[model samples]
Target: MSKPIIATTSLAGCFGCHMAILDIDARILQLIDLVEFNKSPIDDIKTFTKECDIGIIEGGCCNSENIHVLKEFRKHCKILISLGECAIMGGLPALRNGIPVKECLEEAYLNGPTVGRNTERILPNDEELPMILDKVYPCHEIVKIDYYLPGCPPKADLIWAAVVALVTGDELNIPYELVKFD
Candidate 1:
């Protein structure tokens, strides 16, 4: 029998989720034996070449491009998972919800102490830059997410459990210690 195909992406996040995936240690070998990866940073695959059985997304949407990619992920995968607190509720990025985009930009680019020596005071108006949304949006708010793994970076075992359950048709048992918020 062929292995299930998995795809993953990180958006508007710290990339800690991906690191956690690696934290499963040697068990990753077991994962490799169970499934294949596509369009994920792990494989350096930039585009979807085939339909995927599962898609794991980390982080929330904070710009037009993130939304676009997320929608595409939903269309291409049979089971889409919101793999972190960011994907579940916009996480730390959602802290910007109450703050206006204009103010955020000024704080990040023009006025913040760390932005020093910005005599030009430009706020990245290039055409290549994506348009920032007024507020970060959780993945479920934008598309139909089939599952959610709530964590700042979701413990490695939690991720492993979720993936194994889906691929092997087993019920998932999330340990109490692994289910955390903050």
Candidate 2:
């Protein structure tokens, strides 16, 4: 039998979740033996080359592009897993949920001290840029997420164990300490 295909993506996040996947150390070799990676930063695959058995999403959707990519994952993968707190509940980015979008844009573009010399007070309106959402939305809110692994960055042990179990049809050993929110 062939190994499963796994794809991963990080949307409105710090990439901490993806880093945790790599923190599995030597177990990563086992992962390589058990699955083929597709459309993941792990291999820098920019597009989905083929259908995948598993899709691991690491962050919430904060823009149009995130939604597009996430929907594409839902279309291409047999199973979709939300891999961290951000993907499950929007996390830190959701702090701006109640704040007005205009305020946030002003703070970043016009009023920010780092961006001095704003002679024209230009706010980014490029067609090439993905439009920011009024508020960050969790992955499940945007699409049908089949599973959630909740953590600020989910411990490497938890990720390794979960993926191994999913691939091999074994039971999960998710201890209380492994499913942290912070």
Candidate 3:
């Protein structure tokens, strides 16, 4: 029988969750026998595969591209998982939501020690740029999320458990040990 198709995508994140996915390591070979990666590390960008049984989305939606990718994933995948804290809770980048969008952009392009000077001449919010949402929203808020795995970057075990449960058609019961911060 053919293995299930799994598609993973990263939004505006550091790609740490994708790295953690590899943490499955030796077991990944076994997983390879049981799963086909349709998107992710090897495939930088892809139209969502209709054959995808599981879609893992890392990072939060901070830009139009991220939102577009997410909606496409939802339309294609049977089960969509919000992977890692960024997807689940907005992550570190979401902290910027507290600051004015202009201020944040200025910090990066107009006021930062190095790049600030040149940005003054740069056009402020234009048609080319996506508008920032008034507040950061978790994946579920934008689209229905089938499952969420939380953690700055979820542990390999969590990813493994989520997938194993998914492949076997079992419910994922996250243990307390995995969630306890201390």
Candidate 4:
């Protein structure tokens, strides 16, 4: 039988969730034996080459490009898992949710303490750049997320348990400690 395929991506959050996946350490070898990676940064695959069994998203939607990628994942994968606090609840990036995008952009590109060198006072207007969203949004707000693994970056054990359960058709068994943040 063919192995289940998994894809993953990072959007607006820190890449910490991806790093947490690596925290599983040697068990990653077991994980590799159980599934195939597609369209994942881990394998350096930039686009989906085939339909995937699972899609793991690590961050929130903060720009048009993020929305496009999330939608593509929804289209190509049968199950979508939000794999960290950012994916589940918009995390640190959503701190800007109360602020206007224009003010944020101005502070970042024209008036913040670090912008002294922006003599042209230009804001990024290139068409190639992804349009910024009004605010960061959790993955579920934008797509039909099938599951959520919540944490600043979910515990490695929780990630491993969830992936194994899904791939193996076993019930997920997460310990209370694994789910606890404080």
Q: What is the lDDT of residue 160 in candidate 1?
A: 90
lDDT agreement of model 3 with the native: 0.80
RMSD in Å for all candidates: 1.1, 0.9, 2.4, 1.0
Candidate 1 lDDT over 1-182, as tens digits, reads: 88899999998888999999999999988999999999999999999998999999999999999999999899999999998899999998899899999999999999888888889889889999999999999999999999998887899988999899999899988879997875
Residue-level lDDT for 114 in candidate 4: 78
Per-residue lDDT over 1-182 for candidate 4, one digit per residue giving the tens place of the 0 to 100 score: 99999999999979999999999999999999999999998999999999999999999999999999999999999999998888998999999999999999999999898787888889999999999999999999998999999887789999999999999999987888898441
Q: Tell me the TM-score of each prediction against the true structure.
A: 0.96, 0.97, 0.87, 0.97
lDDT of each: 0.92, 0.93, 0.80, 0.94
Q: Name the lDDT of candidate 2.
A: 0.93
Candidate 1, which segments miss by more than 4 Å at Cα?
none
Q: Candidate 4 clash total?
A: 0
For candidate 2, report its TM-score. Answer: 0.97
RMSD to native, candidate 1: 1.1
Which residue segments of model 4 deviate by more than 4 Å?
none
lDDT of 3 at 62: 87
Residue 88 CA error for candidate 4 (Å)?
Answer: 0.7
